[model samples]
Target: MSQMLALAILILVLFIGEAVSIRTKAWIPSIFVSGVLFLLGFWTFFPPEIVTLAGIPPAVAVMLIYLLITNMGTLLSLQELKEQWKTILIAISGILGIVAALFGIGTLLFDFQTVVVAIPPLVGGLVSALIMSEGAAAAGLPTLAVFAIVIYVVQGFAGYPLTSIMLKKEGKNLLEKFRNNELTAKQLPGEQSGTTEKTVREPRMFAKMPEKYNTDFFKFFRLALVGYLAYLTSVLLTPVVGISPFVLCLLFGVIARSIGFLERHPLQKANGFGFAIMGLLLFIFDGLKNATPSMMVEIMYPLIGCIVIGVAGMYIFSLIVGKLLKVSKEMAFAVSLTALYGFPADYIITVEVINSLTKDEQEREVLTSHMLPPMLVAGFITVTIVSVILAGIFVGFL
Candidate 1:
């Protein structure tokens, strides 16, 4: 295919997947849909180099990962992070549950190598999957590499409905509380509850600079600098400390944001986040090029085993942690499942459940206020922070 045609085909597939996801209210994830299409396309007529032809080379994807991870740091403020400590503890415990189950039972059903390759993606999302995929490929284990991608592609099917059910139950319970006047819409600390007034805090590092002077190019430049520094620190410390560059990028991104060295949502501010993410997704799909129907079938035993065990682990651990923390089991379990599909899905499912349970704006606000923070925090802690760190460490085992 021509370069333009190849790029168009790739983008078209992503567009269709996104459309389907939105239409389904994220019952079906965009990644799952796009991943299936890519697999089918590669198994049939698509060129193995279609991703490259689409102009998203491996190097470009790697660069985007660094920048995007750094941008993720700007997603939450230090106070926001501190306020979600309970969510963080619960989420991390749930991941540990997955690890325990996988190591304890998964190793028995599958080989140790198989369990090692499976755990990262099971505990996190695309980045963890990418880390495992790349690690498996480097270790000359093509099947394991494909296994990582397959795990990431399908794990959401298990997570979405389960999380939706839990959230719905939690929402209804909250609605009951709202009706009884036991619950009320309340603003988070330092945040205004209603939309009547907006809080606009100036960036500390650039407080004196006018908004117009903080151009897109400047944001990109700052983001790139942070990414570079992260890479450099990883190079110096990884061998000695066993940290991944991706993890460093995330840490440095958070620190940079906290210190006001970078703006909030730097990539989005630069208007480059979407394309950067698309490039990373394309790079992930590139692994599908080598997968065949037979290979997929061969890996099914371990595939099914890992997911079942992993999620079971998440449930048990989440419940334990929730009880100790005095959090409701349903909400805690829902938070734990963020490991399966993070971010937009976690956010989407919460909103969908809240919308389904109540039409009253005040009630909706109360439910959202109660549920959304924990879910978002759980996702950030598990997928954004812990997963990358785990993947970096786990890949070494593989």
Candidate 2:
């Protein structure tokens, strides 16, 4: 279990994950697949030292996620959300449904510790997982800390197909509308008043770098510095305001982008930042290695119940909210499921769905432009923002 051996094993697993995902048309995300592979490898070959070696510093993960949120900020604009208020409100209602469901049904089926730990994954994303784990561990339920990560992993498997199917269906329906020349990006009432094409900017082919930063290396350094500063600010304010550092990081990212410190497409050019995220994700899997098969077996029944009940709650709530919001049930359901998958999964599924349904660039463009905003904004709302807040509160109760 030397460092080299651990790195090599991780590389091999990554390759296998990519191959399998390509072969299966990404019905399985490569990250989840790699995680399962790591689980097996850990059981078979990774000694304790190797498992330890597989992890990177937690700050690296924090900084990477901050950069990612910043990039997400660049992709969206408040003005654009004016046209997407229905989607946003529906997403919010969807989250409310999940919280209500957990308290309503979850209390009956699972004990208090299980119900509390379940809140993290139900809220969704890695940030929620880490926050809830820390909260649970602080409350002296160390075993429940592990449940946060386990539930995060379990949600992905339960969520993937449902998300995929919804996206595909939405794409198909949108494509048909395009063929009939009926699809248009409508500005729903209460959306901010503006021209159809507002001033929200896309990543330019050439980003203008600030003076003293001439190279891509320097540009990335500046972005990383912004993220680091944001993290530090969050730490300083957490005692006063009691918000998660990650949320502060996301806010700072949006602010930095607004002021022109970070580029619009940081992920495209920030190779180091991308590697940090990859390493951090690997670290998450390494944490999973700590959970032996026996540990998983103990919670399997409750885990299944969580997944089934959580997803069902989302769909049922979406139905009620969608009608109120004037969004179709299908779109509402797809967006609600973001509670389970979040981020790149939401982004990836949207792209894959559009690609599968249409070849015409114009049609694809129309669908993508419409579909992406809701998914992106919804993910930011549920996974990045509310989830962390909910985890913060729920952990205390536990």
Candidate 3:
């Protein structure tokens, strides 16, 4: 296929997936739909080089990871994180559960290599999958690399309905409490009762810069600078600290943002986030080029086993920790499941459940106030922070 034609087809598939996700309220994820289409295309007549033809090479994808993750760092709110400490504890416990269960039961059922490749993606998302796939490929285990991607592709199917059900149950329970006056909007956990307390804004380093002078090019330069510093830090510290460059990128991004060296969501501010994400997605799907129907069939048993075992572990641990922490079991489990599909899905599911349960604006506000914080915090902790760290650690086992 011509380069332009290939790129168009890729974008069309992405557009279709996104449209479907929006219409269904993300009951079906865009990545799932896009992944299936890519697999089918590759299995049939589509050329293996289609992703390259579309102008997203591996190096481009790697570069995007740095920029995008650095941008992700700028999105952190230290105050919000501090307030949601219980949610953070529960989220971490849930990940530990996945790790223990997978290492114990998963290794017994599958080979050590299969379990290793499956665990990171099970606990995280694309970056974890990318880390594991690249590690597996470099270790000369193409099937395991494909297995990592497959886990990322299908795990959301397991997470979405389960989280939706949990959130709905929790929402209904909270609504009942609200109706009976047992709970007030001000009584919601993790929410401030009123805005009586003043917040002191930290001084930003670029505060004096003219608005027009803070151009997109300048934003990109700041993001790239942080990314490069992250790379340099990783090079110097990896042997000493054993952290990956990507993990350092996320950390430095957070530090850079905290110090006001970078703005919040810098890539989005620069209008480059979507294209960066597109390039990364193309790089991820490019792995599908080597996968055959038989290879997929071969990994099915281990794939299914890892997800089942991992989620079961997460649920069990989250429930135990939630009970001890005095959190609702439903809310805790829903938060734990953020590992499966983070961010907008977590946000979407919370809103959808609240909307479905009540029409009262006050009730909606009450429910959102109680539920959204834990869910969002859990996602940031697991998918954004823990996963990359875990992937960096897990990849070495391969």
Q: Give the winner by TM-score.
A: 2
Q: lDDT tens digits, residues 267-349, model 2?
A: 66655545654665665566666667887897788888877887777788888989987787778888888888677667766
TM-score per prediction, in order, is 0.79, 0.82, 0.76
Better of 1 and 2 by TM-score: 2
Per-residue lDDT of candidate 3, residues 239-349 (tens digit): 777556766776787788777788767887789987987787777678777667887789888878899999999999999999999999998899999998675456656
What tens digits encode model 1's per-residue C-alpha lDDT throughout 238-271? Answer: 6787566766676777788878788667787689
Which 10 successive residues of model 2 have the least lDDT summed? 197-206
Clashes (backbone N, CA, C under 3 Å), per candidate, total 0, 1, 0
Regions of model 1 farther than 4 Å from truth: 111-113, 125-149, 160-201, 341-398
Candidate 2, which segments miss by more than 4 Å at Cα? Answer: 2-5, 47-55, 134-143, 184-214, 258-261, 270-277, 355-364
Model 3 ranges with Cα > 4 A deviation: 111-113, 125-149, 160-203, 341-398
User: Which 10 consecutive residues of model 1 have the lowest summed lDDT?
Assistant: 189-198
For model 2, state the Cα shift of residue 113 in Å. Answer: 3.4
> Using lDDT as the measure, which candidate wins?
1
Error of 1 at 26 (Å): 2.7
